[model samples]
Target: MTRQRYHHGDLRRALLSAAAEAIAESGVNSLSMRDLARRAGVSHAAPGHHFADKAGLLTALATDGFQQLAKALGTSRLASNSLLELGVTYLRFALAHRGTFEVMFRTDLYHAADPDLLAARQRAADALYAGMADLPDAPAVASEEVREVALAAWSMVHGFATLWLSGAFPDSAAEDPVEAARVILGRVFTLHAGVIPSPEAS
Candidate 1:
């Protein structure tokens, strides 16, 4: 019998990449350390060295998801752009990275309280808000105020993505999720006093 070596090139990243695909195809509930190791062509214990247990692996996955999301949302555009574009991007990420998106928000599985995980999550959220803060229509308020706005923005996009992913949205919506998300989120972004004002309201 041949023994597998632990010293593998980019083992952590390899495992994460494979796990992401597995989670995308089969929910995290279907993922196992041994299965991941087999997919990675490594020993079962190899994953433990990087992630102590299932929760640990999930934490790492969530952390990485946050980092990637932050990067995607962090791109700087015009000096005074609309957050609607950022919202579109967020929805796009969820569609593109379905697996990571699922784990990142599923607090039931991943430990949101873990310091490392918490910090990563916060950083990702902060990155999104920071982009919003630079928007032309950004409210002139405290950080928390902007955060609230960010949350509202996030909810619209996240909701649209979730519905789309779950196939709850009609096939017509899938025909153009981005445009659909944009229209739905545009209303949420611009609506006020239970009414979406005309462009002349500015």
Candidate 2:
């Protein structure tokens, strides 16, 4: 394939976009800087100029994914202020950005200790936890109880997204993932209504 030339500052973005496409088509294991360069219409070395290696590229991709996820969650929180809505948004992000979602959690695939990656991951986490606190029944202050509730909520949504993406759901449930997720997540919140005991109760 003929190499395509990239503008002065477009190569990095082009390479990242190509890498996502390649991961979606094949898998992370099959992705290579050389292949990404070809897909982006640049010299093989072009990718290296931006990303030192495969891990570097994947790290950058994961960072971008986390930032995007955080923004989506923040938007949902503002528009609906509903925990269920936040959970649904999480699922939607995962399915829509399958390639990035697949790479985001696989620590073995990238430099897990990278500062930017860690910061981005924290931003996404904070968004989810903030939604929990926005709930009407949330604790009055940030405490161990609040953290526990947030963790449970995160686990449930994250698990559902992972399972859905891996094709683990049957045809019936898979037909409408958003609705299915809504029902499932709704029940979870309902089951744990008033999860954090009120001050009056204590």
The most accurate candidate by lDDT is 2
Using all chains and alpha carbons, the TM-scores for the candidates as numbered come to: 0.83, 0.88
lDDT of 2 at 27: 87
**Every model: Cα RMSD to truth:** 4.0, 4.3
Whole-model Cα lDDT per candidate?
0.77, 0.84
Residue 50 alpha-carbon offset, candidate 2, angstroms: 0.1
lDDT (10s digit) by residue, model 2, range 1-202: 2333355577777788888888988989999888997788777787777888999999999999999999999899989888788889999998888888889999999999999999999999888787476576443446557778888888899999998877888874538999999888887776567664545567
Candidate 1, 107-194: lDDT as tens digits: 9887779898888888788777775555765444565577787776677778888888888976754388888877877776666223
